[model samples]
Target: MNQQRIDGGARRAVFAPVDNRARVDAVVRRIGDAIELGLLGDGEQLPGESELAGQLGVSTVTLREALMALRQQGLVTTRRGRGGGSFVSLPEVPGEERLKARLRGWSTEELRDLGDHWAALSGAAARLAAERTEPEDLVQLRRTAAELAQADEAAACSRLYGRFHVELAAAAQSARLTREQVALQTEVGALLCLVLGDGEYREEVSERLRFVISAVQDGAHESAREPAERCVRESTARLIALRLTL
Candidate 1:
């Protein structure tokens, strides 16, 4: 296995074209989410402006604008003169208090609805992966689950947790599903740190993630869906509970 091939699905997604309706924001989000999820490494150089614009089906002007926005957000850094280009700069995860304050802005109903959508996407991805993917194709999924289990902090755990589902969708071989999972994670993945921060619950979710992987590898599509959905539902329930305390 080529080491670089790991999580390639997400890398492909990060540079894929934007929705066009909001091209600048879309580019910022696609790249930003990839950085936050660790799909792109710190200090990794991005494609040149012209090449990147071509890859993303955007104009050079649009790409430059988006890059400027990323620079302002501290997600990207640019160098001048020879060998100059945009580089990834991973942002630090918010402190617990900041995370709580962010979570407080979401109503319980909103969290529930987002969870439902998340469950649907994850369940469908799991089922498709079981039916469509080879066991060997699941190495990335297994690797992500293992990483999640060993992750020492809430931020690391949340990134690996979200990465697992994204890889699951990738294993399903549905580019659209993969992209949807990426976009969805940018919205909810960080908030996951709030619940996954608990050691006990994190361990439980890790086990559930392993079960999801096992079912997919075993070709048990139906069995794969339940654990995936349950994991999301449990996490969402935890978040909602925490929100009430705020």
Candidate 2:
């Protein structure tokens, strides 16, 4: 993978270990998620053990255990000499056949309910972002969206597309909102990977994303919410259609 394609500030994801319960597991999961989301590139060396532990609020021992688990899972590897540390090792994304099976397992009603919840979260984030975003913060939003639009691989686009919403919540200037959006994205991001390879769907989504960004950039708060909500709804509808085809 070309790290240069994703070399931007948005790719440096911050770790937030809420409450420190099961700290090692939390460290492993967050690092894995960062890799899956394309925020951490393949071959990117992690921070030094102590520094990484501090960032995730885990002890060095806990961090070591987490890194070992990642190594076992093939998600991270360690080196011996100078300029060496644990480095990200991204796995192949699940295949379309596997994704199709996943879609088949979910009822339309269930998927619709999840979409409704996602829409509420994203819709409000877009509205708040349009209303509250500063000129400088818009840069991150545009960068993320542009990254999604330009992503050459389905796996990369899937992660970048999802990250755009999380960035919007951050742009809204509410920490709580940002956290909530991240959590929601984490939950649904895997499902999105299933359909990202479809050129038609990907193009439509790219256009919708740009519309939402334009509305936010123009400070059209009300206009931002509709396209944002519609984007969620339309994407989920396509996924549900995939369910029926299986």
Tens-digit lDDT string for candidate 2 (1-246): 467545654354433344443777667667866766567998999999999989888789889998997887677989989978889976565555544544554678978888998898889989989999778978877787777777767777777887888888888887987898788777567668878888777877888888888888889898889999999998789778877777
| lDDT for model 1 | 0.85
* True-structure lDDT of candidate 2: 0.79
Worst 10 residues of 2 by lDDT: 12-21
Residue-level lDDT of model 1, residues 1-246, one tens digit each, is: 565775587678778875554888768767775776577999999999999999999998889999998887777999989999999986574556646655765789989999999999999999999999886878898888888889989988988988998998999899999999988888888689889889999899889998998888889898889888998899999999999999
lDDT of 2 at 72: 71
Worst 10 residues of 1 by lDDT: 93-102
CA-lDDT, candidates in order: 0.85, 0.79
